[model samples]
Each structure stands twice: as structure tokens, then as C-alpha cells.
Target: MAKILVVDDAKFMRMTLKNILTNGEHDVIGEASNGKEAVELYKELAPDLVTMDITMPEMNGMDALNEIVASSDDARVIMCSAMGQQKMVVEAIEQGAKDFIVKPFDEARVLEAVARVLR
Candidate 1:
């Protein structure tokens, strides 16, 4: 199982993701409420994967993704996006995000994405 860091501004969302990933047999190393914290945690935790929210108060996911990738080229980030954030998703991919999941998350899809990226 891969160690994961979950980044989301909403408490419920972060909890839901933690439950799903843990149930799927992955280790959740850390959780962050904003992109800035996510980046800091990423460095400190050095998790194998990260699930990052696209929109946040301090820093957006795109910026965090870029920074993480810059810090570690092997950084694997899966962006959490809403239905209308296709443009941002594409940009994230271009910025080196491993993959993405739509908000109002699907447990199966989220697990699948995580598994694929980890693999």
C-alpha cells in the first residue's frame, strides 16, 4: 500500500477521503486543509501519493502541484476537481499531476485512481 497525503479545505471531504483510502488498504500519512500546508506536509511526510483539492484559500491545487513536482519530480498528485473544472484539470495534468478525480467523489473511482497511480 502507498502512503498518501490528502489535501482538502472541507473537513468532511478530508474525512471521507481518509476513510475510503484506508478501507482500500492504503496508508494515509497526513491531511492538509490548504495547498500551502499540503506542500509543507508533502516535504515532511514524503508520502507516495497526494490527493489535492483544486480550489483553496491560501494556495490553489495547481500551484501546489507545480511546487510539489518542482520539489520532487516523482511526486504523484491526483487533483480533486468539480465537474466544471475541466480547464483546470487539463492544466494540472500538464503541470505533472498523475491523474484526477471529480468532486462528489466516487469511492470506486477514487480507489481506482489511487491504485493506478501507485502502481
Candidate 2:
């Protein structure tokens, strides 16, 4: 199990993610509503993994993903967005996201992505 940061604008999504990760025995170090908060908390918590949502009120996840990667090459980020565009996924990978997961999160997929990134 890894320390994880869950970033999403939706409260329910964050809570749901928390439940799943906790069940998987991973400690959720922190949660962020947007990419900006994600970055700031990222610096503070420095979790083993970050699950980020794409669209938000301020500072989208991709930009935050880039920022985090720029700040720390060791940062392991998993993009969790509703966006299924091939270009977006490719760009996220190019920008240093370790993995991608679609929203309306599946417990299996989420855990699988986390495990893959942590590996």
C-alpha cells in the first residue's frame, strides 16, 4: 500500500476514492479539490501517488501534472478524468503522468492503476 493524494472537484468522488484506497490498505495522505490545491498539498504531503481530475475551477489537472513533474521527477501521478480523448491521454503520458483512469471510478481499475504506478 502506498500513501496517496486524491484530487477532484467533487466531494463525493474524493470520499469514494478514500474509501477504496483505505480498503486497499493505502493511507490517503491528503485530498485536493483542484489542481492548484493538488500542487500545494503535493509539496506538503509528498505522497507516493496522486490521482488527479482533469477539469476544475482553477488550474486543470494536466497543468498541475506538468508542474508536479517539473518540480519532482519522482512524482507519480495518475490522471483520473472523465475525458477519454486519445490526445488527452497521450498528452498526459507525455507530460509525465504514470497512468490514466476514467471517472465514475471503478474500484478494480483505480486500484490496478495505483498498483501499476507504485510498481
Best by lDDT: 1
Any residue pairs clashing in model 1, and if so which? none
Predicted model with the maximum TM-score: 1
State the lDDT of candidate 2 residue by residue for 62-111, as single tens digits: 99999999999799999886855657878999989999988788999989
> Per-residue lDDT for 74 in model 1?
88
Q: Score each candidate by Cα lDDT.
A: 0.95, 0.91
lDDT of 1 by residue, 1-93 (tens): 899999999999999999999999999999999999999999999999999999998998899999999999789999999899999999999
What's model 1's lDDT at 66? 90
TM-score for all models, in order of appearance: 0.98, 0.95
